[model samples]
Target chain A: MSGTPNQGPGLRYPSNKKSIYDRNLNRTKNAELSRAAFAYLFIEMIAYAQRGVSNVGDLEQKLNTQGYPIGLRLLDLLLSRSSNPLASIRPTRILPLLQFIAQTLYRHLFGRPADALEKSSTEPGQYMLFDNEPMVSQYVSLPRELSSLNCAAFVAGVIEGVCDGAGFPTEGVTAHSVGEQEQGKDAKAMWPDKTVFLIKFKPEVLEREEILGRGGG
Target chain B: MVVFALMIISKSGGLIYNREFHTGLSKLTSNDYLILAGSFHGMHAITSQLSPAPRIPYITPQNNMLAPSPFPNRPTGIEVMESSHFRLQCFQTQTGTKFLLVTEPQQPNVDTMMKKVYELYADYVMKNPFYTVEMPIRCEKFDRGLDGFIKVRG
Candidate 1:
């Protein structure tokens, strides 16, 4: 093992110029993606889902699962992309993570923030993440066998993972298809398939959910 | 146009899907639907064989393909049904997979709708790791997509 400067996998960072972290995070924003790139990427994503799913539901879940990593990666990417980016991506509290996911991640993926993040009235450990429509499963269909499965569960898993990774242990996350009404159709009345990603925290997460929920009350 | 319902039948023509959208059309017995699929399958094979021998289209004079021409003037293996309520169009993918769509006959862009349904089938139904081909197709994503597409257009 020659002790050469350019050889071997050692903890060597870039020298000379300012390190990436040394620069103000706000400096890096407004990267552009070509429309065709997004279209092709989305098409390939659909094709990948198509070739892998055993059923419609499984496919959607796969898409959601795919998005989960994006969500996780987005948590940091958005910060790095932020006009006023953070110095070190320190999500000291759960609220910031959810906000980043709902706003930063949502806008990055859907061109807008999620509609809302609400607590389930019945379930104490549960929180609902809302979107008018989920993009990944936008054109998916679930077969009969998967009538009970929720593809959004993948998103839920992602959120849970993020939460857990960030010192917030959580239970399972589930996506419940809640229908949307438009185009002269009462989608909710007939088809309640709008996805509501249920984020159920672990006992620890529940404690935090309570701590967060009891902000005023 | 709104896509009301879609059914995928096996090569044997077994009913693999029986979903409803907006308003499902008249109900047929599950057994009857299976019979219908099988009968339709039998008819499809005959029609495909009966399709005139692949006369090489002037477009492809080279005749590069050794096997029977993929572009035989074969019937698309598509069928349709119409009632005052809705029009049903059957579309077959290149892989001999079938997609039946129920929509309003007067719908301006039914073809696009059918194509989208086919796309959804390929995406959600085909890509699902848990899904097994040549068996029942049960997927939640497919249903959600159908619900959204129909809800928006219908």
Candidate 2:
């Protein structure tokens, strides 16, 4: 510190003498984190969230909360990364936003677009984003007591965050193990961890969409 | 061609980030900045509504077939406000967060500069876990990134 005159009085520099500010955001664009390392960290995160939880639903909610900010952060980061700054455009409508999440956000996080995206026929404002195999919960095996809990609630939280960050406020986003219901016994046996994220937008969002669609804006 | 200042407004019309790079313009109190952001947000909304409707919808040639353009005709509000002294260029994200850049009247490529600013905001400010949504920005990395970018480009 004494040898460097430009150094701040109380600031400490790492051996590399580079701060997060000095690093390029795109440096990790094509980089892949080790799956084992990620799994370890994720296990720790789940363990932390599990403490003092009374029920499985509460535990899932806690996990969801933990992933919410991540979704918010990724919303802008991925948007900036996806397009040329000169000709960049963000999704303003419902379908485009869902497509962005189903395609861009999925690929960025899981190395591929989601398996399917479907608007719920029974509900006007509800949509379903499907992942044939959720990477986060692949290694997670819930005991018989907690079989009702789907660890993919964290991913659902992330989806909720993305929707909320994009200005399409959702009523809530929840994850369910839909493999059993949607598939035959053979299919379910093949991919037991298949999950679906149900995204229900707020009524105001649908109203705005209706107006915008009518106005062609 | 000199850059002057930058202001960021949240979707709810709050001045979330404000910084001055050059010293040419008159200084205003922090309260004035809040008012500026709020009024600017309102003005932007009004300008979009005030825009004249396009007489014909945009069409595109797709697979050798003429089809209506997929892009929505959302009216972008006040994009550039120019005056004798400085030019105020605004870039509004789809989420309605506005980035305002004040530059010298003759400055070129202000849009590119604004984009860089947005990128910095996305990386340093948004990614920082401490940052609350729609709150005033106080990220050290963001400040450093902005300063470095302006020093290089300006």
RMSD of each: 9.3, 27.6
Q: What is each model's TM-score for chain A?
A: 0.61, 0.89
User: lDDT per residue, candidate 2, A139-169, as tens digits?
Assistant: 5645556778888899999999999998999
RMSD of 2: 27.6
lDDT of 2 by residue, B1-154 (tens): 5888899999999999999998857899999998999999999999999998656653455544755456556788899999998899999887789999988899988878888898888766654433558988877558877988999986
Give TM per candidate: 0.53, 0.54
- Candidate 2: which docking quality band? incorrect
When summed lDDT is taken over every stretch of 10 residues in candidate 1 chain A, the lowest stretch is: A179-188
Q: Mark the regions of model 1 whose C-alpha exceeds 4 Å error after superposition.
A: A1-73, A86-89, A119-128, A136-148, A164-187, A194-217, B1-8, B17-33, B56-90, B99-131, B136-154
Lowest lDDT 10-residue stretch of candidate 2 chain A: A81-90
lDDT for each candidate structure: 0.65, 0.84
DockQ of 2: 0.01
Residue B152 lDDT in candidate 1: 80
Q: For candidate 1, what is the TM-score?
A: 0.53
What lDDT tens digits, residue by residue, belong to model 1 across residues B19-47?
76655457778887778778767777777
